[model samples]
Target chain A: MVKLTADNIEMRFGERLLYRFQHLSLAQNQTIHLQGDNGSGKTTLMKMFAGLIAPSSGEINIQGADSLPWWRRNPLLGKAVYLHQHPYLFEGSVAANLSYVHSLCEGDKATIMARTEQAAKLAQLDHLMQQNAANLSGGERQRLAIARAWIMQPKLLMLDEPTSNMDKLSQELVLTLIKDLQKQGTGMLISSHQACVLTQLCNQMWKIEQQGLTSTQHTPTMAKYSNTGQSQEFSYVTAS
Target chain B: MNDGWLALIQQALSLLFSLDPEVWSIVSVSFSVSFAALAITLIPSLILGFILAFGRFPGRWLVTNLIQTLQSIPTVVIGLLVYLMLTRMGPLGDLKWLFTQKGMILGQMLICAPVLVAMSQAAFTSVDRRAWETSRTLGASWARAVWTVCRELKVPLLMAIVAAFSRILTEVGCSMMVGGNIADVTRNIPTAIALETSKGDFAQAIALGLVLLILSLVLNFTLGTLRGKAEPRSH
Candidate 1:
């Protein structure tokens, strides 16, 4: 199973320390909900795990990654797919964006193409295949970004505020995609300030508060509320 | 006077259309030299620009400022420096490139590289950081990620190239100083125009002038169309 482990990681910006944690590990079949206040460096932490940025003072090791060439320094990159809160869509059609990761995928051409078509359909973007990704609305852009990641079928995925700009219908669509990924045993680290439909899927919770990180095994009560159609109240209690 | 002007214009057009050997040779020499300079300088200058924009290292600020200063230095000054280097007593004198097209190309490369580097650096600096992050997170290699970013800023990078080409093509100072305006050898459009106009031979000068003007119009209009089509990206 693919796994990421960080030890004695301390993040700081110039002179101001953001947060410090002693030990953390994310592995396959683990679904984590990251919680923090605004400006708590949730995004920065996720980016660090994705190899987009270096930690101020720590080493992060990746297990079960392919042996990279000597010139390729960080193995964490491409091992974990990180989705930004406001996803960036390339200057091309929706179809182009969906197929961009095809070359990076390990499958054969036909399999990759089939996965691309499936992602487009699952994201409900098949109708807009020829449309320019730049012209897509915020919700549509998020969907397209997730769909692009879905085509990769990554071992680990980090979603930073995945449903922030999404509506109810769009959220449902994304939820279904994430559920499918979970069923396929993809590890996920999803960051959200408050509990939402997506967070309910998490079996563990990580909260960053007052320059410290704490982890706990979380049994989501919202699933029952969701079933009983009282999720609005559950969301309010968890948010506070 | 109007009749004289009309006759000169007619003669210029005729020389161009008929492809008079002398006029065409000058045009050919100018293009060949300038194109050589641009080709030799393009990739290295762009790589330097990208490093300046993204890499953090000691002396980066000093290098950036030096390049900005180089962009503003007069082309004639650059020509003088190149001339000294290629002179008989200078360090590079053994190669004996002075008064030749090689000398002209060397002079023009010095004039062209700064503009390309500075402009491309600006273009790369203005690129969205998310572009790089997204590409890397999507499993693109570092080289591929950089290529993707460059593709996104293709219009601006192209503008830099066009600007550098125009500068080198139209520069008479470097060509005249280093090349000594040798006929059919180092005499480019600008240098030829200067020599012909000095001798009151207006027809050939006007013909070469017309070529430069047409080239300028074509390059600018093409860049304008590209700029117009590149919609402003939103976050």
Candidate 2:
């Protein structure tokens, strides 16, 4: 199983400290909800795990992956995929973006082509394949970004505020895609300040507050809807 | 006087259409020398530009400023420097490149490199950071990722190349000093134009001038089409 572990990690920018965590490990079949307020380094932490940046002081190790060649500098890259808050879609049509990522994936030609088509359909972007990705709506852009990663079927995925600014229908669409990936045992670390449809899927929580990080077992309170959808009951519980 | 001007224009067109050997030879020399210099300097200058834009090292700011300063120095000054370096008593005297095409190419390289580097650096710096991150995270090799970013900035990078080529191709001082403007040997369009004008051969000068004008129009229009196609990115 793919795994990532960080030990005694501390992040700092100039003289200001961001956060410090003693030990953390994420492995396949584990889904985590990373919670923090604005500027609490949520994005920074996700980028760190994605190997896009280095922490001030710490070692991060990835296990159960093929050995990278000497020329491949960062071992953590391609190990986990990180989606930005406002996803960056390449300059092209939706089909072109999907084809771009499809070229990077390791699979037979036919299988990858099939996966690309399936990803587009799952993200509800099949009809918009010929449209310019730059002209896509905010939700469509995020969906396209996630669809690109979904083609790879990455072992781990980090979503940074994936649902923010998304309409309810778009959020539900993204939730469906994430739910499929979870069923396929893709480890996920989703960062959001408030509980959303995606946060309900996490079995564990990591919260950053006052320059410290805490981990806990979480059982998210699911909203129960009536047939008329007029009244709802809310419940909250957590296990330390 | 108007009739004299009309006759000169007619003669210029005739020389060009007839493919007059001397005029075409000078045109050939200009293109060959400029092309050689651009070919030799293109990859190295772009690599340096990329490093300046992305790599962090000591003296980076100083180097960037130095290149910016170099871009504005007069071509005549560069010609003089190359002349001194290639002169008999100079350090490079043993190579004996003085007053030769090699010497002209060397001078043009110095004239073009700074333009390529500075403009390319600006283009690279203007690229979104997420382009690189997205490529790397999507499992592209380092070289592939750089290529992708270059693809994304193709218009600007190509404009840099065209700007550098135009600068070197139109420069007269360096070719005159370092190449000696010898007929059928090292003479180029700009130097030939300067020579023909001075010798009252207005037809040949105007012919060469037309060639430069046409080339400039073509390059600019091509770049304009490309820039028009590259829609402004949203994020």
State which candidate has the highest TM-score: 1
- What are the per-residue Cα lDDT tens digits for candidate 1 across B110-213? 99999999999999999999999999999899899989999899999999999999999999889999999999999999999999999999999999999999
Give lDDT tens digits, candidate 2, residues A17-87: 99999999988899998989999999999999999999999989889877999999798898888998988
lDDT value, residue B60 of candidate 1: 95
Mark the regions of model 2 whose C-alpha exceeds 4 Å error after superposition: A223-236
Q: TM-scores for chain A, candidates in order?
A: 0.94, 0.94
* Candidate 2 structure quality by residue, lDDT tens digits, B1-235: 6999999989999999999998999899999999999999999999899999999999999999999999999999999999999999988888999999999999999999999999999999999999989888888888888888899899999999999999999998889999999989999999999999999999999999999999999999999999998767785
Lowest summed lDDT window (length 10), candidate 1 chain B:
B226-235
lDDT per residue for candidate 1 within A1-240, as digits (tens), equals: 999999999999999999999999999899998999999999999999999999999989999888999878889989989999999888878998888898999989999999999999999999999998888888889999999999999999999999885777788889889998999899999999876768888888899999999988777665542533223423213322
- Candidate 1: TM-score of chain A is 0.94
Q: What local lDDT score does residue B158 receive in model 1, on the 0 to 100 scale?
A: 97
